[model samples]
Each structure stands twice: as structure tokens, then as C-alpha cells.
Target: MSRRCELTGKAVLTGNLVSHSNRKTRRRFLPNLVNVTLTSDALQRSVKLRVSANALKSVDHRGGLDAFLIKASVDDLSPKAAELKRAVQKATASTAAAA
Candidate 1:
């Protein structure tokens, strides 16, 4: 499988590295991904996901891995849920700008 973050949709990026001599070299920037198991009701089993460190951090910071599931209800959102959401959004925007 590719090194893609299923949670945040982050993937490896390709670009060029410019040196002081004005020479450019090809380079790859891989996302920080980890293989994690998440519970799934449809399959009645745990599903593995390749998620970025930032995405995982957002989930854990809000609650835990369970919150990363798409089907998870928002009723149980933590008191700091909004903060976490904003943080994730900001991070994503910053990444996009950098790219």
C-alpha cells in the first residue's frame, strides 16, 4: 500500500531541492503515517488505517482513536472538541500553503 494518511488524506509529495549553487535535485517528502486499528460497525471488526501523525494527534488530543471513525457520532464530542477541530483545520491549511 502507498504511504498515505487515510484520516487526513495526506500523501507523499515530490518536488525539487534547490542548493546554494542554484542546482535542483529531485526529492520526496513522505507524510508521517502509522498503521492503526479502528473499530468498524459495518464489518463488525477492526479496520486498519494508515494515518498521518498530525491526524492521529488530533484524534488523541480530542479523545482517542475511536473518534477518527467516519461513522462516529458527534454527540460525544469532548469539551475541547472545537479547539481540536480548529487546530486540525489550521494545520491542513498551513500544509496546503507550504505545498
Candidate 2:
């Protein structure tokens, strides 16, 4: 349970918080991570993921979990999300081969 978005790989960023007196303090900028259940059309199942709000919007823009995973880079996805992407790819490939 780290503060990271499973889909987009968004993580806590370290930065300086400058005060009114021109003093700087260390601070963290965290992504807006939300627990969401997204449906995969290829797998025909719903998967739970902790994703950033921006990532969620991208998922919608890209067309759903399957499409998003298919288009996403493997380096950006978490282990679980990468696994799901593989599964979805396999499932879709199998269907395409059959047809």
C-alpha cells in the first residue's frame, strides 16, 4: 500500500514548501489516488485498482480498461495491472484467432 497509482505510476513527489518569510520546508505532492473498479470488455470482468484521477480520465478517454491497458506502456503499469493487461491481450488474441 504505497502512495502510487497502479495505472499511471503516479507517486508522491518531493518538493519545497516556501513560507511567507522565505523559509523553505520539505513537502510531498501526492497524486489523487482513488480505489476504483474498472470493467474490462476483453476479460469480461471488473478489476479493482488504485489509480490517479488523471489516469481514470485517460481510461475513459482511451475507451476502457482493456483499451487503456493495451495502449499503456508496461513500465508504467504495476505488477497486478501488467498481469491484467497480459490476460486481456491473451483473451483478445484468442478471440481474434478464433474469428
Off by over 4 Å in 2: none
In each prediction, how many residue pairs overlap at the backbone (N, C-alpha, C within less than 3 A)? 0, 0
Q: Residue 27: error of model 1 in Å? A: 1.2
lDDT of each: 0.60, 0.95
Candidate 2: deviation at residue 3, Å? 0.5
Candidate 1 off by > 4 Å: 38-46, 70-99
Worst 10-residue lDDT window, candidate 1: 70-79
- Candidate 2 per-residue lDDT, tens place, 1-99, comes to 899999999999999999999999999998999999999889888999999999999999998899999999999999999999999999999999999
Judged by whole-model lDDT over C-alpha atoms, candidate 1 comes out at 0.60
